[model samples]
Target: MAPSNQLEVPQKSRVTVVGSGNWGSVAAKLIAFNTLHINSFHDEVRMWVFEETLPSGENLSDVINRTNENVKYLPGIKLPKNVVADPDIEHAVRDANMLVFVTPHQFMEGICKRLVGKIREDAVAISLIKGMEVKREGPCMISSLISEILGISCCVLMGANIANEIAVEKFSEATVGYRENKEIAEKWVQLFNTPYFMVSAVQDVEGVELCGTLKNVVALAAGFVDGLEMGNNTKAAIMRIGLREMKALSKLLFPSVKDNTFFESCGVADLITTCLGGRNRRCADAFARNGGKRSFDELEAEMLQGQKLQGVSTAKEVYEVLSHRGWLELFPLFTTVHEICSGRLAPSAIVEYTEHSARLPLLESPVHLN
Candidate 1:
């Protein structure tokens, strides 16, 4: 028989989102919907807003708290009433046993450092950011960095999810990449899945993440193809080559990575969408249209407003990794993307390099088929 004096657990399971940007807002909205319907979760989804002033002279957090929307980042969308926005990151993460991190990859390390000793001991995290940090040791995935810094298990969610489309409740699918815990992964699926947004879990975190990371570099190449007014055949060729390089790099980095994971929403789906419609592609298109006269930094400022592009940085980082490991010759597409981005080669050189590399057997190696 159970003891009558046993302590009862709180009916409300707390959740917090560690970002309030475009994707962050959508994640909060999705989690807010689930928290209301899923009895195990707390109704209020706390979203940490990195405080900033909008074009108007208003506090962003106050506006979000009052209007129940992230008007600046995700304008024209109504967030649920239960989604609370706070500027205090520490306060935001204090009680949250489940944390969703969707901030820009550049700011993630600082954010993780700040959260030290503040979160619950049993907290689990999910990283939606796509990119990595290249140190002297090597490229560290955002999820891995989070796990190492925060002393928590971190899962990743990646897909062909465009924030604007998801914000409007358009149908989409995402993959949750976890290490070993199926039950934990399912909880994440429950938090994110909806009629419009389907979520599935897989055990290959590195494959899903590398697909998300490297696809941006490919998108840059695709954007060049678009800027050059290249036809569909050229763009298709670039994508095919990019996908092959993506698989090779992922397997090279982590032998445990599964080839089938590349078929999931996080892999090919992400690569396709990013090349066709992502911000990186758009900016790269602009860079190419201008004949590479202006730098990507200048275009990103003029075009993206305040948002950052991940591809350009990812290219340099990946190139650094390849160079350090003496593996640059093994990845022609990857190396060429960086060289082109740095103006060492013309935008047209994207095609030229890939074509030249293809004719040669430089990238050949004994590898598993994807």
Candidate 2:
């Protein structure tokens, strides 16, 4: 049936990316292409730049707007014309109906606080961030923080997506985790899907998100093994143990999370990609090379340029949760990663301190979650 004249016209959706890092820039590139092709979405894509000066003393935002490239973070790749770089977060997201939050997870709370009562009432958000916030009460996922602070329904996108490879249009896959709204989730799928970038939607938000977050801790362990020059079999063993821990931790935290979600792009695929190529693995390799003499903060600054490794902080945060709940003894790998990162144990101990040495007596038993 045709709508009457009194019926309101649907408002076109405007897109804004509230970050300017490597992944953030790639995310803008992907969304810019989609918004222009989809009639329901506005042509302009606003990306919020934290506003830094380049080494040559040029304004980063101005350079991106003039050159159509994120000259500092994601150099050498051309961004779409519609992807406008804005320095002001408020102005960038002013008229935006679809906000993509991709900043480092640590800054999200402050960012959300600034967006309270400022964003569109109907705005929906999706987090491309892979880290989680651990409060004294418990852990808070980025999606939950956004929903609580902005009063918006938020979903999460995660997988084995590396920023540089995705920017060059390599084949990759991602998973969108939604709470309930299938329609909203499909809209996100449309906004992100590309020929080279495949996207899928799943109903298990916590499962997909934990897969993304917890994998960082595991990646750190993988890095330690690499630094130790352990053979392929040893690394494979670490990976297998890490995968079991990841699934067990997820199930213990959120029982509703499906077992099969671990088989999706956000699960095993992400774990493999991150372990092999992610910054955490790279830095962990370096940390091991130095014999843990230099602190992670110092190494991060020297090794990663300005980019932060999510695994180091994530391992610490996960440790906090495990300790608070008296579950540290149950999670041997996680506990060891934190201890090793904090310089308590040598890199080689990644193998020595197995579940056998921990307080758990069922180390030889089959993988089962209590």
Candidate 3:
């Protein structure tokens, strides 16, 4: 349960959003949904807006006053109006009490660096993106990356759930991990928790971040097996093994988080979503169907168009780094998938690796196979 007495929930607060992409847009919408009291404090409180775009490409803009009826992605629901989109990075962080990052993981470091001087020292920083650094960093997770760039500790918002599913106010669960400061963590949980959005608070930043980050790897493997047209028996075996791998890595990397064993929320829950709804799987499917001719970027863009999910370029990056380092003990399926993606091994090799690495007995079929 979230502690109400500890969190400082302001009647109205300014939140600066860093990105306006699919995830960014959903995050901004959530900010508006959670801060519905801003109008009550009209003169006293205004939700100031700050939004940023990629520098090299043409500047991007967000659709404001977009209702669920108007927006195709949004379900039939009403949206709040206080949240405004600003293109200026400096102006966005200026005087804002909360900062939320929804950009891709690769772009977050640079974006945070740009706002380092401008961000209010007291403002809470939160990142919704999940992935590891492209470059070598020993034991550094997404939270550490944010702390390094911002020069301050920040909380992470992550889970197995997807944005489109959340945007529609579907019933789902997520975990908010923060430092030992239980007060700060609960505040965030309360801020985001609505009728349909149930949030759990964790003192373990590493565990929470790892669950969010590593699930992509497992999901990629799941996608590979699924794309191979492996039956549910094979898919189920992969999922169970994937959970064990996640638990082992979690124990090694983040011992503080109680119960590293993956459950529906962290391990099993997120893995299935990513493998089935995940964009990485779609990308893998494209490669499998096309005979691996197109470039990574082309396959990724095509997957996004069809599935409307973020591409897993960063996930593939992490897979490569870990596999090269010989840290393949925990996530063997991921390692296998990585090999297939890199052209070092063929698709059939994935099945062979899983059979070789798995230690537990294969699951018995619950239904008769045709």
Candidate 4:
């Protein structure tokens, strides 16, 4: 069927972005471009906001920077002034066509819960998060949890693409998963599709979400390998095992998604970047570089004393959840977790473990199912 005027043209498309971190800022900017590219807005890109953050890193920013009031993060990007930075929830979601969530994984559910009271039923919600909620039985996958709470099926965007690369308009590609309806899913793919930013559609939202979340775990493992002075061979070995562990864990959580290859764009692509970011890896690297170096607690305390430790608590929660399940055979990277937990296994030992566990098969295709 041809796209009717009603479907082809948005009735009234106003997009609101929920977070203002690096990914959030980049995504909000792109969505502004997407709306403009579709010619869906006649008078500027519908209102957008960076949604401010509080001092403790909570997203409730009380002090607004008037100097940095414009929505475009980079100068000369030429964002339409219509895309305003609104901090109020009611003002942001009111009469909007879509809401995009770009906050940290742990914060997504609470934010989604808050939106339930505000957003209209017809409006579509998009999740750009890449981690699972560390929970038992249900709502483990991020999308499912949001969809269930919102009482509407939510779509997810995941891929090997990076924020910095995309912000500069470099070549990038991504996969959009919509479990609600194929037509709805394709609408987003077509809406944001551009020559440089290739977008594909997939019905396996579970696979996409699980892959997105699990790869970060593998990244921590890779960082551990890096901390240990592991060679390229060792790094490659960790990558292979990491993908397998992702496959096994994803299989257990989202059985609906049968594709087990975690080496795809969303899996391995995201994995490499997370390792290179060097946050969690720094923890291991510090331990590896010095002998009888500061204990984990001492290192964490010392690091927190100087710079912020963002994801240590979240990573610890992930480790604890995995341990509670007693699902060791399912997660070979849990070997890395065990070493981190046991206090006996040094950073170098993580490299040896990677070498020992490197026999898993490589993924056949870099891309997963459609």
**Best-fitting candidate, scored by TM-score:** 1
RMSD (CA, Å), candidate 3 to true, equals 7.6
Please, what's the RMSD in Å of model 2? Answer: 2.7
> Candidate 1 on 1-370: residue-level lDDT in tens?
7799998886567999999988999999999999999999989999999999977889999999899888888988999999999999999999999999999899999999999999999899999999999988888999999999999999999999999999999999999999999999999999999999999999999998999989999999999999999988999989988888898888888878888999999999999999998999999889889989999999998998777899999999999999998888777888998998899988988888878656655333535422
Q: Report per-prediction Cα RMSD to one decimal.
A: 2.3, 2.7, 7.6, 6.1
TM-score of each: 0.95, 0.95, 0.81, 0.77
Q: Which stretches of candidate 4 lie over 4 Å from their true place?
A: 1-10, 41-80, 260-264, 276-321, 338-345, 359-370
Local accuracy by lDDT, each model: 0.91, 0.90, 0.63, 0.61
Candidate with more favorable, higher TM-score: 1 or 3 = 1
- Compose the digit string of candidate 4's lDDT tens values, residues 227-271: 667667777777777777667656665566656334445666666
Check candidate 1 and list the clashing pairs: none
lDDT of 3 by residue, 142-169 (tens): 6777778777767887876777787787
Q: How does candidate 4 score on lDDT?
A: 0.61
Least well predicted 10-residue stretch by lDDT in candidate 4:
60-69
* Order by TM-score, highest first: 1, 2, 3, 4
lDDT of 1 at 274: 90
Clashes per model (N, Cα, C within 3 A) = 0, 0, 2, 0
Runs in model 3 lying further than 4 Å from the true structure: 1-12, 38-79, 134-139, 306-312, 320-325, 360-370
Order by lDDT, highest first: 1, 2, 3, 4
- In terms of TM-score, which candidate is stronger, 2 or 4? 2
Clashing pairs in 2: none
